[model samples]
Structure formats: C-alpha cells, structure tokens
Target: MPVADDIKSSWADEVELEGGALPPSTEVRENGFKIVTDYKYNEDEKKLKIVRTYKIEKRTVSKSIALRKTWKKFGESATDKPGPNPATTIASEDVYMQYVTSKEEDNKPEDESSIDKLKSLGDKSVVRCRTCGQEHWTTKCPWKDTVLIGGKLPDDKKGPAVTTGFTNAETGKPGGSKYVPPNMRDGAAKRTDSTNMARRDDTTAIRVSNLSESTTENDLEDLVKPFGPIQKLYLAKDKTTGACKGFAYIHFKFRNDAAKAIQALNGHGYDHLILNVDWSKPPTHSNQ
Candidate 1:
C-alpha cells in the first residue's frame, strides 16, 4: 500500500513534548500566598500598576461556632444556599435620632384624676418652705425675711388656704389650693408675746472677761456649767484666727445660779488670766 498524505492524525499517534505550554498569568502557589495576576506601566505618568489577589488559609474555629455554621437555615433563608445572601443581608446604614417636644400635646386637656394624682405625687417630693410652709425651697420663700414666732407665721400674715394635698381625717375633704403658713396648720398651738419675751430676757445672763485667747466654747462651758443649766453660751472669737476674743456670755436658766457664778468666779485665776465675771448688761442705744 502507498502512503496517503491527506490522512488525519489520531491522539494515539500524537507524541508528548517537554516544556511545551507557557505558564498562566497568575503563578500557582500554596494557599495563603499573594499572587500577582496583572501589571501595567504608564510611561507618561511615570507609574507602575499591579493587581494582586490573596487566598487566605483555613483557620481553626471553636466547636460551637463550627456547629452553628452547619445548622440548616429557615424562614426566608430556608431556600438560601450556604453563605450570606446579598439580597437578604446588606450593610446597615448609620441612623441619627433627636428629641423634640410635641406642641400639639401641650394644648391637650389633662384629665382631672390625672391632675390630682400628679399633685399628690408632687406633694411627696416638693420641698416645704420653713418660712411660709409653701411647696418651694426655704431659700425661695416669698416670706423669707418675715419674722416667725415658734416656727409659725402671725395671724395677719397667714395665707388664705392650705394646699398641702392632705385630706382632713375627720371631714374627708380635699385641702384648699392656697399656700398656708406652718403656724396656721391644724392642731398647731398659739404662741403669746409674753412667752417670746421671756425667752429673750437677758437678766440671768452673765459676761466673763479677761479670758485667754485659746479658750474654746467647751472649755468655757466646763468652767461655769456647775452653777446651773446653761440656756446658751457664746464665746467671742476672732473671725480670721478663730482665737477667743477674751470675752464670753453665758446665760443661765435662773438668776440665782448666775449670781452664784459671778460671786465665785470673779477675780478667779484661770488659763493664766484673772476671770472678771459680772452680769451681762443690756445694750444701751443712744437717742438718735
């Protein structure tokens, strides 16, 4: 038989050649290695451009997390394949919020019961002014400068009504809606002028002079406390240094006790100074 030149070749007749094909654009390497796939150079800009892709190696994860990943998805995600669905899972945008008072609600009429409840709650928390017994701080009381006798206001200065939100135990009626002074409260006793004047009397008070600068109120109290129950004791001291100003006033509950203290303590040696004890004289005002 003669050789046919136009016959097609089969795969069995083809022979393998060494180093025949060129390598791919991306170099093959182990996982976690960075591979450069494309690069370009710009001559006018004097810059080189290169693109790279990294294959991160598989990391060991906790058993709980790995198990959770294997849990079958449900709800809208039941038909979703493994991995997050771009349609259902998207990046969250930042949200901003602000506080704004509603003007429409300000004009709304409040229920009477709600108003009473609020007033009751406020009575528990609101400060009771000592000066006027009003629902305000003592410093903000309108009658702060007014004189009070036994912590009660005078009859003429009393307010029209009481708004303490307290119900009368016997009558079972709501207290009126006006501020009431503490003195005018139910069961409050009346104070007379004679009692107030008796408390202010200085007849039983004695003065001690020539005291040491280091004498304290306690030291002076100890010196004359044996005489009688001391009503009030005041030790005059320097405002800047806090040292005794060499004089003190001690008031006794009885004039006889004060007289005994004066007779015994006068010219007595104490704290390296002679104690000059005498009855405290009332201040004399020059006729203006």
Candidate 2:
C-alpha cells in the first residue's frame, strides 16, 4: 500500500501477564520502518503501562532559512571578487534607467507636449484685431486708444477676447464651422498654446515656491537652464499688480532631467528666498 508522507497513527495495545494466551489476532502491516514500542509493568506489583513512539522527517525548508542560505552564497561570491569600478557602476545605472524608460514607453502612450503645434505654427498665420477692426488682440488693439472714456482709454476694458477656432478662406483650416473676422482674432492661437503647454507636462514639471516678488520669467529660466532643456517656464503673477506671486513652474524635456533639477536645486538660495522644488502634481480638472 502507498503511504502518505510522515503519517503517524497511535493506538493502545494490551498484553496481559496472566492470560492463557496473548492475543494472536493482533497484526502489523506495511514495513519500510519498524514499529518500536516500550512497556512498563510492575515487576511484582501487578501494574502495567504502554508507550508508543514515532520518528519524524521534515522535508520542507522555511522561507527564512532559504533566504539566509541565498545571502550566504552572495556574501561568499562578493568576498572572493574584486571591488566594482565606480565609473562602470554609474554608467550601468544610467543604461538600466534608459532601458526601463523605453520599456515603459512601449506599454504607455507616447509623451506629447502642449506647445508642439504652437511651435509648428509660429507667426506664419497672422490674427486680426477686433477692437480697432485691425489685426491684433484686444490688449494690443489700436482702437483702445481711440475709445474715449472721460477723455482717456477705459481702464476696465482691455480689448475683445482673442478669437480662436475661427477659420478664414486663406491659410486656414478648411470646413471650419464659423468664420472670425480678421478684425476679431489676434494672437489667439499663440495665447491658447502657451496656456495648454503650461499644464501639459506633469511628468517633467517642477514646482518652485518661495520666490521673491522681484523674480522675473527670465530669471527663473536662467536658474534652471543649467539642469536641462526647458520646455516652458511660467512665473505666477497677480493680475491686478502684475507682480510675481512667489511661485513658479518649470517644465523640462525629460523626467530624468527634471529629477536631477529637483535634487540639485531644492532648498537652493535664490535672490531673496530659498527655493522649494518638487514634482508638480497633475492639475485638477474639476477646479479648472
């Protein structure tokens, strides 16, 4: 008969001292290992006792034990080998990171920039101004000068909203639903492109806070330009005062480059404030 691994069964066996015949019907079977037993009976007190014993052989190793064995082997190999080269160690890490990034890109969507289209469509397409019936945005409209408000241009009205999505017969997307008068659209695409580009590069964006009010866009650009190629730099400003809000964002072309910037630039001293740099969180859509 086939036996289960490490099966141990126990039963009582009676052997009478004064019996006419000890039980001959008792039987044992299946014999790779012998059944061992011990008996204890009073030599002359007429008392009896029975005992049973079995041997156990465990075949499974514990996880901790296996881990210790692996560590021992690794340590032995390290003790026998020479130390690794420092330059090779750094280069290997860089190569490994590139491999990992490429694998991740294969599994995910291609990274895209918000300003890619804007870069493609520089000043080739000119926008017209709506306020003065000329080609310009409301802020740059010449008619703002013509509008008389107490014999002066009104402080409240800047100009007509920059027109976008409007198609023209010449050098415009065909089959556009609506046509914006050349007088109505000025620098609309450029403005929209900048806004979208500001929010698009979450993977490469670094949030910098505690900026001095005097810090300018050019200053922020120069500060981080040493780290990597910058895709965009936007310094938050108060609309009313047109001054820096003590915070800014910088987007680098690569995540690795952004990480390097964060490591090297965080807590670094600027003009008047120590910069706090970190990865920018993705914008919340609901708030916008």
In the range 1-288, model 2's lDDT, one tens digit per residue, is 346444443232223433423323222223433233323346674544343222334457999886764553354355432223233444333443344356766643332332344345776235544443344445655434332112122333323343223324233322333545433434233454556565566779999999999888988888899998998788999999989999988889998999999999899999967989999987677333
Q: Can you write out model 1's per-residue Cα lDDT over 130-229, one digit (the tens) per residue?
A: 6556666677555453333233545453333322333332242224324444454432323333334544668899999999999999999999999999
Q: Against the correct fold, how does model 2 do in TM-score? A: 0.31
Give the C-alpha miss distance for residue 103 in model 2, angstroms.
Answer: 58
Off by over 4 Å in 1: 1-200, 286-288
Listed in order, each prediction's TM-score against the native is 0.34, 0.31
**lDDT of each model, Cα atoms only?**
0.67, 0.59
- Least well predicted 10-residue stretch by lDDT in candidate 2: 146-155
Residue 189, candidate 1: alpha-carbon lDDT: 24
lDDT for 53 (candidate 1): 47
Q: Candidate 2: what lDDT?
A: 0.59
Query: Could you tell me how far off, in angstroms, the CA of residue 268 lies in candidate 1 after the best superposition?
Result: 1.0
